[model samples]
Target: MDLDALVARRRLGWERLRVLSRQRHLDGAQADELLDGYQRVATDLSTVRSAAPDPSLVTHLSGLLAGARLRSAGTRTFSWDMVGRFFVEDFPAALYRLRWWWILTALANVVVGLALGVWLYHHPVVENTLLSSVEVQQLVQTDFESYYSEHAASSFATLVWINNAWVAAQCIVFGVLGLPVIYVLWQNISNVAVIGSLMHQHGRADVFWGMLSPHGLLELTAIFVAAGVGLRLFWSWVAPGPRTRLSSLAHEGRTAAGVSLGLVVVLLISGLIEAFVTPSPLPTWARVGIGVLALLLFLVYVFTLGRSAVRRGITGDVDESLEAHVAPTAG
Candidate 1:
């Protein structure tokens, strides 16, 4: 009940715990002693809180306990090992696990874009409504091709990376709402369709594909992956299977976060291709080949490495040690 008396009684033990916690290394016996001291001091703090109610003593004990807890638990640091594990295991495993979602998303968008391009090509009136004769001529002749080369390569790459990354992030973050992801995809695909239709109509289809195919393939795939992952996050709560809705959402959300991070690197690669390769003096075939190669490597990485990782029970989630503790439920 007496604060002063309690402090006097526990001071030696508290000091011992502090010393153990601050030690860079500890023997088994010293570790045990530290644990015992931690328990006793915790009890003392509780008693002082109820009986003595001394704020200063409470604060000191709280700080001491926090240090001890950290020492006991240890700390994780950034390392090459962590980066290797993430790309090899976590990121790809996530992509493989959710492959169907993004694949379907890619397919649907392609279909829509193609169908719209065809319709717009046939309906000259639609293009007239969207762009005047001069505007169309300018876009087909100059704007489409010049846009890529208008800026410095490094700056253009950075700009494209930021813009694409933001779009991908939005797809994941707003995926839970369902409609927003679709809206984002529609806006992207429709613009492409309109431009492609106009280019083909004006007999500049070569210019359009030659410029776009160099970076658009991988860039668009990364976006599809984000949209798919986002839709999956939304579905986690919608159809949670046997798990509670909250639990399912938490699991998928963690995976989605990892996917978002991985997409940053993917978009960066695509951005580089867009800036350097797309507008390079290289032949159109060589440029498109580079883009095709990049997409193929990404796909192979996802299917081969990702599939293997997923088979080993990696769901692209954070380490089990990092996950929140879930209460066990009986079947």
Candidate 2:
């Protein structure tokens, strides 16, 4: 446990490990020597720290071993460029590549909602069963509009944003189940359809569309995108095609995760519109136009920027250097 003796015994091995760690590239012989020296130095450091406990010696060996570890396994650091590329390329590319899936999801949901609305409109008995005549009348006349303005705009926006984001997150996170995503979508569609039907019946159809279209355009689209991604995540394993099931799932799941991140912003915009525009005294056309404009901007970002990003080989994944490698083939 003598400090001097301990330093003398391990200092040479530790120096060798340090030198090897500093090298940018190692020849075959050097690489083998590096590994050998690394192992020896690591053991020496452990023995010295336990027996000698000299702060200076322990510190030097510890630093040497840390450097060797880094050299042996490699390391990475986050950079601003990575953040910039993610927003400009990775996020949009994922959305664009998965465009068809989401488009189909949007269409299906709209159709289901419309069908449900029509059916409910035709069946007064169904409405009566769900809600009393008086309650239905209140919903049609005042409750529907009052709901938007019931709270102050800022707090309402925050609440709506958090609620919508949670729903979208659930869709993506639980998307592997497949059925959950559909169930969520069905629940949403049913709510809208029931309210829509009641409004139409009460001659408040204009009010219904006006209240919804301002925020619903983008809000629903974001939800549809999340649902599509979730569905795709489920489908990746079911029909991975040429790729191994795990590989396909990982790839698609990574892309789907990007949609989740992107949708947070999308849903926020929708929430803002719903709070500020929907209940504002602004003309319905102007408010709806703002929503349409927001949706259009998102679409352009996806189709235009996304297509370009994909062509450039961005897949909303970590850069290739960070990606896992396949083992070399014997052939």
Which residue segments of model 1 deviate by more than 4 Å?
1-71, 329-331
lDDT of 2 by residue, 159-227 (tens): 999999998988898899899999999999999999999999989998999999999999999999999
Best TM-score among the predictions, by candidate number: 1
Q: Distance from true position, residue 276, model 1, in Å?
A: 0.4
lDDT tens per residue, model 1, 20-45: 99999999998898888878877877
C-alpha displacement of 288 in model 1, angstroms? 0.8
Q: Which window of 10 residues has the lowest lDDT sum in candidate 2?
A: 322-331
Report lDDT per candidate: 0.92, 0.86
Model 1 — which ten-residue stretch has the worst lDDT? Answer: 322-331
